[model samples]
Target: MVQLWKLVLLCGLLAGTSASLLDIRGNDVLRRLISGLERGLDTFDSTIEIIFQNLKTELESRCSDEVVEQQETENFLEQLISRIFQVVSRLTGVRIRNVQVPDITFEATSENSANVSIPITADVTVSLPFLGEIVDLDLNVDLQTTVSIETDTDDPQVVVGECTNNPESISLTVLHSRFGLLNDVVDIGVNLARRVVSSVVEGELCPRFRELLESLDAECVEKLIGESQDTTQQEPEGRR
Candidate 1:
């Protein structure tokens, strides 16, 4: 009975040992599969991170370039206005004490280029002591007038001459005339204003005025102005 009991006990121990070894093998396979899945997930996460980082860097670079380009464009427009004023003053035989750019804007036609436009307003004050000397002139004559400025590249001389001759191109209000000669003073102011504004418009659109403008750091303005002047100069000189 004792020997039989010993054999049964031994068999039981062997069975338990075999079951434990199988369980260990199964656990090792499960661990290996889980590790492989984790490694794949880690690689995928790293790739996604790299892609996002690259996109972010590209966007920042593009935005920065755009900002710099916009700034340069604004500077160019400002210089253009300054050059126009300088050339105008030279042509009109007037002292432009101040030239101001009130507003400037641009419209983008493509990623690399834009069209810039500016609106200019000027205040002209003239001194007419000669008008005060005219004792017979009517002081109460209504002297308010309206003025318009036009820019043309073609046939600039004709356009400028027309503007100078047109009474409507310059508007003036006789605020006060010295020595009570309001009519003479008003006339002087009108003539001065017309001459100055017309000269400026002509200079801005004339090819001959490009050298003077380029000296003012307005290369872009000169280019556009030159194109217009060339077209106008090509027409028959007497056609206008």
Candidate 2:
């Protein structure tokens, strides 16, 4: 009779242990982890704005008549950009200001991947060097980027799987303008250039985004994901 009681207690203990181990959902852990990561890299928009600021400065620099000679000729891309900046800057100075970041949200897309929505707004001022401040634009951009934990190698790290911008979500409203014709021209120019801009932003942002993730404590992410991994190991035992 004592042996029978002992068996009942053992089975109960085993069942309890299995429940405790399997109770944690991988998605739940991932959500919290991604939330933490988002907080850690809250300066994502600011970083993006900095890139644009650099672009503005570069444009202004290249716009000057006494052109700065190319220090690095290896990159043909830079040479092409310098020419574009010179023409645009000489015609009209583009100043980006009043930048704002949006509340980003995340959704678990896969075991180790998430989809994040980011919306940003900025004010763009276009000025003819001689005429001054010809047009002011309110720019709105909405984009989504896929972030994932890459663990194929020894060092598990966060990477940007993909970044996409909603074409319909991009708009440049002429808030105030001195020249209506120039404003229309600028609007058309922006519309035509939007895709190229998005492509450049995505290319520029991914590397910075990866760097932000790398800067954070990767071990914390590993621990959060590891807990789920450990819990899943109990499946065979539970079946028994």
Instruction: Judge candidate 2 against the unseen true structure and give its global Cα lDDT, from 0 to 1.
Output: 0.47
Q: What are the Cα lDDT values of the candidates?
A: 0.36, 0.47
lDDT of 2 at 83: 35
Give the per-residue lDDT of model 1 (tens digit) for 198-233: 433443322222222222222333333444445556
How many clashing residue pairs, candidate 1? 2
Q: Best lDDT goes to which candidate?
A: 2
lDDT of 2 by residue, 6-109 (tens): 98687667544433332222223334334433443223333434444454444334324576666842322233233332332222234555556533344555
Off by over 4 Å in 2: 1-92, 150-157, 165-169, 181-184, 188-203, 214-240
Q: What overall lDDT, based on C-alpha atoms, would model 1 receive against the true structure?
A: 0.36
Clashing pairs in 2: none
Candidate 1: stretches off by over 4 Å: 1-93, 106-117, 128-176, 205-240
